[model samples]
Target chain A: MHSDTKAPLALKLSAIGGLIFLLAPIALIFLYAFTTEEKSYQFPPPGLTLKWIGVTMGRDDVWQALGLSLKVAAIATVLAMVLGTLTAAAVARSRFFGREAISLLVILPIALPGIITGISLRSAFALLDIPFSTWTIVLGHTTFCIVVVYNNAVARFRRTSGSLIDAAMDLGADGVQTFRLVILPNIGTALMAGGMLAFALSFDEVIVTTFTAGNQSTLPIWMLEELVRPRQRPVTNVVAMAVVLVTVLPILAAYYLTRDGAETAGSEK
Target chain B: MTSPAIFAPRSGVLARAADWAIRHPRMFVFLMVLPIVLWLGIVYIGALIALLMQSFFSIDEFSGVVQHEFTLKTYAELLRPSNFAIIARTVAMAAAVTLASAVLAFPMAYFAARYARGKWKALFYIGVMLPLWSSYLVKVYAWKLVLAKEGILTWIFAQLHLSWLLDAVLAIPVVGGNSLSVSYLGTFIVFVYIWLPYMIIPVQAALERVPAPLLEAASDLGATPKQSFRMVLLPLALPGIVAGSIFTFSLTLGDYIIPQIVGSGRLFIGQAVYTQQGTAGNIPLAAAFTVVPIVIMGVYLWGARKMGAFDAL
Candidate 1:
């Protein structure tokens, strides 16, 4: 807080450099999407064109993948919100045995490697003979998405005054009425923020989806396949630009919704 | 006013049930927790255990069918020199990326937490998070293009007449190669770029918590700024650094896509698992390979919990 305690010039420069390093690759994604060269990545593109946008729009496969991705993300987010809120209420609002272990169990899916989750789910599905469909992808996604929503909801639950619930009950309100009239309003924004964050995460998820989605191709899976086969390269980049915008909006919205709260959804304590 | 008791008997069944639920808190808690426990505990953790069990089963070398009997043969196969190399290479790269991210993230996190104010602070925060919100695959592909033989880096080096420098660097032992796109250095760089934000946020969060008075007291007690930073700031921020490393390290260790797109066509644990299961039809070996990251993270998380890293998380 003192002038003498200010960060040095070198430190400031390093910070700026770090930001640039973080952003430059993303900038390249936007830049290459408009490149005239369709197949090859020529450094200084001989020219720039918007033809790739038209090409991307014309592809039915892209549209199909996009539609599937939206469906999966939406369903997964809904499941995450319900189950995550319930878990949060139970863990944060009540004292019980095995609470810490339950908390750890909830967080494990996201904390561990995605590949581990993927393979385990794959093997489990095989073992149970559960057919891989859109629902399977949703099920795989709910595991981690629940962690996101749980973190946000639990933090909000802990922060809300316990006396408010007690007072509602003393005044003859039942549990459902207390929850609907008192608790929901308190945690609505936190739940919405968590759901949005979860949706964003599920939308871009590839690793787990790869293991769970047997035949269905989500947008990222399509992109991965397109990358391997190479048909109209710039078109794939254009679709990537679309993916960026789609995912970024929810994340930014979640940020604004939770900005006043003590904790953000993803960076939970 | 009408007496409220008049409405009590008239209440719907749902309201009565709610009242009953309120009276039985333990039952309510159990009901609330059942779905998640079923999903995360029974389904997810159960799957992990099943996978681990698969790892212990032996795979018939001839028919490639999993025998399902308990045996360490699948794990013993992992000890073969080629398979062991993949594990060693992946761990080394994960360590290198974690170290690099922590070093790079610290100064930026320090500046944002200590020096930046108001609008500048918000901008720094968004700058770090925006990239994370974007497509992970796109960023990795962008690096793939950037590090390609005829890509931007080569062009820039050529413009500066430093192409020979890049060539010489690429000529070094295991890490060096013909081009950045197919070399170990390229994989390491892209891995760091992707996971940098995960490291920055926790470090910034940790640094923001260091009480201003602690630093002031150190300086007021006649300690130099450098000495204060070394003694006070670093110790306090260690947990945050450890927290960030957990994300960076585990993410890198589990990633198959990045190495597939950018690195030399060498096997890493993720790739090995993917290929073994998907192509070779060797579920036992794939399950065994997945355990490498699981075990590593188990130990890493235990150490992190000891350091109170979850507080910063």
Candidate 2:
């Protein structure tokens, strides 16, 4: 109580410092994306323009990479959601002998170092003679993505109140009917949050994608290529900004959907 | 969450099917896990084994195909000081990031879980989480602008007349920074920034479970705010700190993108593995290198479980 008034001033300063640090790099890109001096990393460029955006739009490779990233992320998230939901439902709702082990197994992909997962997937693909392709990337992404969906679904399941399911059943609803009507509605926000987060994770994933992707480059892989090769710096910044927006927007949405009062109560479970 | 009764017993044909389904849950779960398990086994396990076996066998120096004969050459080669240095560097970087993130996260998590009211808490939580959505590559790339020769940080230093202080810090001998160069320090700063949120959220979740009344009771017993934190909060939050550290540690250790973009080409084991696999085309060695992180992680996870990380989450 004593510090409430005393705290606000310090807290305000800290919050402002936090905000600046959080935004500085992101904001810098906005300044650079318009810089007319293309060839170097000079501060306070003599001229500023939107010329780089136009240059970036003209690049076919950027578009192709963007398309591939979208496809891979979408497919991986969908796969993760379907499998994760079924697994979460089975494990969360039932009594099983090795449930703990299964639950741990479900979480391990995302939990273990991405390097371990990446190398494991790469070796396994090699054993199967599976070449690095879009499919391999999707498989790699789904392994981690499943963890996100499973976590959300399980949390939502825990919060739905078992009595509601019993109420539906006692009223003569069948298992499918109850699940379709009652269960889905209750966990919809969690599922959506999970899907959004999973998609964002998969979209930006580079380490695992590096191992799984052979020659085909996603936007991140392309950016990696450009970072190593200096001639494409401006285009890289453009694509980087695009990535900042795409990955950031969903994360913001996920936070709001998950942190809104409704979801905070769900989080308590 | 599920009633567990809806699927218990019923008289109709649908109930009969449900009963049959419940009885055959093993098969259903197996079916659900089959694709992923197969993928994990074939891809991950095979790579790991291939990597291990490759270390035991020699690579044909001329061809690099990994010869058929089993020998201890690669393992012996890996035992060298240079090779060991890479592992040490990686561990050091990871440790620095994890430690820094934990320190930075504590105050923020404390504020949110204990002090903030209503919407402000959610806003803080959201603030902590938003950076997570940004693509890892872009985030790493962003630091280039921060730490580069003429980047914004430099500009700010000039404006504040703090360039001399920065120059002195940068002049520290071991860090190899008489001036700001994109190296280990740059990598460390970004790693800490990027992984800080992972630590904060879990620590906040852990702190929330302390129960407000417990803190009130401690305060009533005449503990100062600082004393209350040490006595009541830290012990309650220890498990979460451990759990969150595992995430931060493992992520930092395995992050090839950040190191590749921000660190020097030969800076860490992540890069070593990438180069071995991609450039050197020594898949087995890359696989073998992956073992180091997996072993460390397995141990850390076991430790976390022993510390009751599950309940904390």
Candidate 3:
């Protein structure tokens, strides 16, 4: 009993330490955002100011880059969800030859290093004479985004009782009707969770985007450029905060959904 | 009903085509896989061929044109001591970050999988993944603030009366002063933090698959808690640890953005490729640079498969 008690306490302390490690960098950003320093190396800012926020909000370039990023992410997420759901359904529902091979192809983009994907996409675009554009960026993102949606949907499909579909069909329901009333209801949460994850992945994706995006800059790319140029640290912070909030909210929603599912699964077993 | 009334020959052609599609499901499968294959072949393979060819040929300085003379000039240049040093440094950095991410992520994964329940578990998992959702640029920017001399960390040190420790660490002769200011260390720290979620999620998924009954059985026997963990849990979770490490290692190795933003253009393979393509205008050399990493990664993947790390991911 004493040993068990000691172990949990030790684990908890280690967990808290991990949390601090995660938050320290974030907290540092928040602190610097309010600083009064001109350069970045000062130990302590002499004062604090809200000037950086205004500067960030006023910058047109930052807005342009952010808008481009949003546009790419939105388009990519929708495409991935649709294709991923279709592919998942086809694979999970119908037994077919070469199924594993097809699944492997779908998972490859995410499993392989992003650099390989980027280079591959870049070469294909060049071959098709598809000029580097926002479309190319979307293509690259959707490739990997599909993997997340597929994983979630497949898991949901596996857990869902096959009898429910059969019973609905037996009750004089047509294929579409059975799908609408039975299938959709069961997988609704899964799909929503998958979509959230896909969106999050698309939002943060940079490696492939860098290669596919010919000249246009995403918010991340813009921040990278600014880092090298060195005049826009505060504005960068503002945009960073915006990104943190946007990405985090949806992920929280997705987590709650998945957790509910996991608990039910645990209880069922 | 109209088939008979329609042209008999045309009907036969339609039937044959339908028969062909059904007969060769491989064809359908091939078509379905075509997009990605074409993507890989045309873009990936094509560019790689172009790059490989470029590496062999030398560039003419008289008119600044790439001349198609088959030679090992670029490889020779890349093999030089200074360039080799850069590769060595990058590998070391990548190895360190992978180790750091694994150590940091293991406990988090363990806690979420073994202890947390219901909504709290979900919330904690989401918190770990939330950083992944944010823009990569924003996160890197946040790190810059954290590590900057005038950043929050410095301020916190002063507030806590720990500035002496900070100064002492920063001022330690050859090991500290110049190196701390260079930003590579800051970049390494941020990379580990930013990629932590990726490492954690897969490991958690793997660890979660370990049956609770097995652990109980071990404990119920003569084995102590530590012994049970060491003997059973660690062996089962080994696949996940390996899977997560590959992500951390490869990501750190290939990433140009974090290093570019945080490492201040200190050359990494990714940055080297970007520079060769964009700044130096040496497309061939850049392509060669890109191939170096791919070859290395290919070898790594093969090794990973041999070790059975592929199963977990």
Candidate 4:
């Protein structure tokens, strides 16, 4: 807070430059979505139009891919919420052998490279005769999705006072009643935040999905295909704009919900 | 009336089970954790083990089918000069990206942690996080457009009458080419842009923990600002830097999409593994190649854990 401790003008200027570097490409994506050019990227488009939005909306394939991505993310978020809540309850509320190991195990899915998870899941499915379907994609997604929920829930659970449960028990409430009335309300926002973040993560995932989705194209996979093999490129940019909207909103919501909670988690250290 | 019903036994089996579980905390914990352990352990870890095992089994060169018998032949093949070059290139790129992100991120992280306050702080954080929220593929592809022959970078260089600057840089060996879009430099720039936020957040977190008194104390003790930053701030922030690098390095190391789209068709570990397993049908080699990043990250994470990096994450 001291004036003497403040950053120099040059440092602030460079930070502004860094922000521009980060955002310029995203800004370009939005700009080009309205460009009239369909074949190649023109620095200064000759014309701008809103017609690509209409075209993108009319495409059945885009709808199918978007629907599949939403379904997969929803299912994966539900799975992560249940399993991750249980994990947080156990690790945060009770002492156990191998607890740290379990935490590490939970984080491993996301901590290791996505390609490793993709390759492993791909082979494991083949070995077990599990066909690559939407279900397969869900399972693959749930692996990393669990980590996000676990991190959030565990932090909130730790911040929750154990004495609340004891107080409820002393007041003649049963376990279910204590959980339903006391514990649930305390961690509800945390779980909601975790679920939203998990959903966002699952929605944009491409690498693992590439391996686990046999013939299926999630929104990201479709976007990748569209980029690699060009066809009416502006249409893909329009779809990208939609994706940015869908994913960014949930992430912002999660940030607001968790911003206060983060201090208690001591993750800032 | 409610007290009378409270003592009554629940009619459903599930309700009785809930009653039993609440009374027995240990068993409750066990029951609560069993499904997750089974899912993560049997399914996820089991898959990883299976993949590792596949690496040991050899592929028949003639039939292009993976054999059940164990062999070290695949590992030996991975040591070939071309394969080694790919490994070296990927690691070098990862290191370079990590360094670039850290250097670029530190000043911003410092400014946010120490100088900015209240709404300014919140705006800075939002700026850092906004890019992370956007689609990763879209960002990479956007960079593709920006670096294309007739894209924004070229347009700017042409306007500046310095078009030959980029051309001269592109004229160099392996890492360069005819245009920015097809060069390793382009891929490096995009990688740094994508992962910069990861570095900034952790570094900011670490800097936030450094007390104002500590810096003031250093100044009081006759340390120059630069000296105090080098001696005090850098050491304090080392764990966070390591934590951030863990994300950037591993993410870059295993990414195939950026290289596939932006580079000059140079093979990274991810692309090689994808091609080997998907196209060539050589499962063993792919598995063997996959082991490289796993081993590298295993060591990196172990070191990071020693530095107390997980707490920051």
Q: Which 10-residue window in model 3 chain A sums to the lowest lDDT?
A: A260-269
lDDT of 1 by residue, B1-313 (tens): 8656544553788877886787698999999898877777787889888877889998888887779788998889999999999999999999999999999999998888888876766678678878777778877777877887877889999999998999999999889777998889999999999999999999988998887788888999998979998999999999999999998998899999988888888988999999988889888899899888988988998999999999987
Work out the TM-score per prediction.
0.91, 0.83, 0.78, 0.92
Q: For residues A8-118, could you state the per-residue lDDT of candidate 2 as single tens digits?
A: 455455654664566677767767777777676677766877888998999999999999999999999999998888778777877666667667776766766677678
Report how far off residue B279 is in candidate 3 (Å): 1.6
The digit string of per-residue lDDT tens for model 3 on A18-50 reads 777765655556666676775553545677888
Better of 1 and 3 by lDDT: 1
lDDT, candidate 4, at B137: 91
Worst-scoring 10-residue span by lDDT in model 4 chain A: A260-269
RMSD of each: 3.4, 5.6, 5.8, 3.4
Task: Give candidate 4 regions above 4 Å deviation.
Answer: A1-6, A96-98, A249-269, B1-8, B23-27, B213-225, B306-313
lDDT of 1 by residue, A71-98 (tens): 9999999999999999999999898887
Residue-wise lDDT of candidate 2 within B10-64, one digit each (tens)?
A: 7888767655664686776666656655655445555656666665666777887
Write down the RMSD of candidate 1 (Cα, Å). Answer: 3.4
What is candidate 4's lDDT per residue for B1-313, written digit by digit as tens?
3446547777677778878887787888888889888878887799898888888999888887789998999999899999988899999999999999999998888888888877766668667777877889988888988998878889999899998888889988877887888898988999999889889989988888888888889999999989998999899888889999998999899999988888888899999999988889887888899899989988988989999987776
Tell me the lDDT of model 1 at A35.
84
lDDT-best of 2 and 4: 4
List model 3 lDDT by residue over B28-110, tens digit each: 44554455455533555565466567778766757757878887887777777867666776788888888888888877777
Better of 1 and 3 by DockQ: 1
